[model samples]
Target: MKYTNPVVKGFYPDPSVCSANGKYYMVCSSFQYFPGVPLFESPDLVNWTQIGYVLTRENQVMLDKINSSGGVFAPTIRYNGGRFYMVTTNDTTRQNFYVYTDDIYGEWSDPVYVDQGGIDPSLFFEDGKTYFMSNGLDDEGRSGVIQCEINIETGEKLSKSICIWQGSGGRYLESPHMYKINGSYYLMAAEGGTEYGHMITYARADSVWGEFVGYAGNPVLTNRNKAPYLIQGIGHGDLIRDKNGDWHILCLGFRQIHMWMPYHNLGREVFLIPVKFSADGWFTAGRDGTAEYEYEIKGDFEQKEKKLYTFKNTSWKIDWCHLRRPDFDNYEFYDDSIVLHGSGITLDDADSPAFIALRQRDFEFELSVRLSVDGGEAGVTCYMCEDEHYDIALRKSPEGTEAVLKLNIGGIKHIENTVELSSDSAVLIVRGDNFRYNFYAASQGSEIYLGSGNTKYLTSEVSGGFTGVMLGLYSIGRNSASFSDFSCNYK
Candidate 1:
């Protein structure tokens, strides 16, 4: 069967996968977003469904006042002894921890902090013992992929961390994962800073501990220089062998909005690439060591896509996510409407505001919402971060309620356009494409077209963040709003 590259879409980056109980479970980095570590389960590698989040409770992870792309780094999920373990880094606090759960659909345990200091933590269990590795300085102050033994029960260091292979001369050596394949320990990692130059590299040794030999064709997978291609930044992969004994790498990659534009606002997403091992035990990924837009894979199931999303069809817990630690009192959800109580918090603040959003899954889409504001401002926003966004909202003017289009880029906050509304209720629309997002407003008469915002300004290349665009409903100041008829349809 043929399937698309990003089996899992949107801002879910740095994918790590492990199989258990005849199913494949994958985890991704959530950054500063609340409910960190998005988790998914797949019967076939080509089709993925979000099961839940690893950090569902507020205490499981910290996002209080966390900046964009600062809270959670890469997360690795592994299943062992009928239990699932998720290890990740809280970059803002410089802490590495792991949480475990026996039930895949149940809550996870509190974090058990590891003494080791590094990001992109991974756990490899073998022979009733566990090994920990991350990209940071070892006990000897040598920096690279550091390895150590840890007590899985307590997360205590059982051995001093030692510097493993420093990678095949690529910058930002990270995402260290170990696998025992055919009696040889294979150490796989990513390099090139998780950007356009990102790539996957590997080494092999007789034992877990090094004197490992790098693959002659190091950087076994990369799309760095593959210009004019929609896919780029392919790296931070976790290898999983399926029931058919075929190897595949679930990695992170981004889709540029336009060919030769070099701008991506949909964030790093999960891509499944085929991996083939030579007789000598070294493996090559994708086609010619580069990920492609589509692949013909061995799967019995047909790939299906969900193009339309509405409040009634999407789950509040599964699909919608907040910016950070949100105040529960500010949100109320019903059958088809959401009531947001603003608490004088604005989007410009790093702290959580009255906002709930779904990741912008594709470039060509239309988002429409009907909202009525009692006070302050209520609207739909194309949010990239605190410093970058575009809003079309209903606010109370001195004369009456008005529909306003505000464009926020860095320090420049401009009210691009405003239309006087006869009432407090209005329908706001945002039609987005590869290059720009067009805004519109309507009450009784025809929809009034507002100004447009360049999508490039909200891209990671310009905004300097790790996240993508989020289509969200937001409220600012002390007010309340009823948002209904929310629908986002992708073309």
Candidate 2:
């Protein structure tokens, strides 16, 4: 079985993967979010398992006031010798750092700061030497790709940097990767500002540093034509070869409507494509710039269903994460349900008190939650940004058993409907197309439609964020709430 685009859906971008010890480990940028840098493990390149995160402690960074796109940027994962290394840029601090671990599942070393004033640091080890490449603005105020050697032990630059390729087309370029294949060094990077003209380009050189030649087929892979949009704006990719010498490219792309431009979703999602090397030593993704049905792999291992979210056996999946750093004191898991205590701030606050959310993908989807509220305002919400959201809450009102459905469109709050419920537990169902939302509520075996409209209010256009949409359960005020049977289905 072959999966074409979006092997992992919804806001999974800037993928970097490295194979080691008969297994593959991958990581991606989780900007402005907590439990930073999702780590995925895979036996075969097609199937993946979410292992854990790189940043699990508060000491990692101060994210209290981190804005939508002001946290972590692009991250590159590489295996050097016996240690697995991850280098990332903290946009807030404008610093690049490196973290490594001997065992993939073991504790990773604290970030060793590299004083490189650039983003998207990729490490390449060749012939007992390590080289670091990044995208930075040069002396002419022209941002170009650069490469330099670094001391592996201490994250320090050992040589003066050299500019290889200053982007093609008149747009900003970033996300650079250096790989040595058959004695020739190849540099792959993204260009065209990651929007409509976003593309992946390559340049080749005889030496690690020097005159690199950009490919005549500059954008080796892109969706610049009309017709089937299986993948759009595909770039920021990393390439790897299996044991049998078959190559694969893991990149990020987005699915968007015509009104949303090309790459205007929350962020990029993961896409896999087969790769072929030309007789001229150049690599191109897929066949003729399109994805393939199936690719070749060397391994002969039996396929298995990878578990994503069973707390005991598998703690968390790469798909499961919060929008920002979560306050552990606000929530806990018990009796197969996640109980959230009310926080002082409402969902409107940039730093909302308690929210456990997952990325929203697909046009038609359903999210159901069985919630029990005791006091103040507490319930489940489908949020797009800080200002735009829709919630079905069980609140304490003058009426007996008060239930309210509220919509915050562009910072303006509108109560769509309110019903009085006599039951303790209520099942809230939120269904939506890409633009509109329908809210439903059920209690005591009775169901009612709460609200239905073009809730475009809950979109990136109305709300301001670097992400698309998120569905999570939240509680606020002075009391607490319990949420069970939390399920999400996407069609």
- Clash number for each model: 0, 1
How well does candidate 2 match the true structure in TM-score terms?
Answer: 0.91
Could you estimate the TM-score for every candidate? 0.99, 0.91
Task: Show model 1 residue runs off by greater than 4 Å.
Answer: none
Candidate 2, 66-146: lDDT as tens digits = 666667888999997899999999888788888889988867888887656678889989889988878995434546887
Native-referenced Cα lDDT, model 2: 0.74
With a 3 Å backbone cut-off (N, CA, C), the pairs that clash in candidate 1 are: none
- Candidate no. 1 TM-score: 0.99
Residue 122's lDDT in candidate 2: 90
- For lDDT, the strongest prediction is 1
- With candidate 1 superimposed using the best TM-score fit, by how many Å does residue 24's alpha carbon deviate from the native? 0.5
Estimate every model's Cα lDDT from 0 to 1: 0.92, 0.74
Location of the lowest summed lDDT over 10 successive residues in candidate 2: 306-315
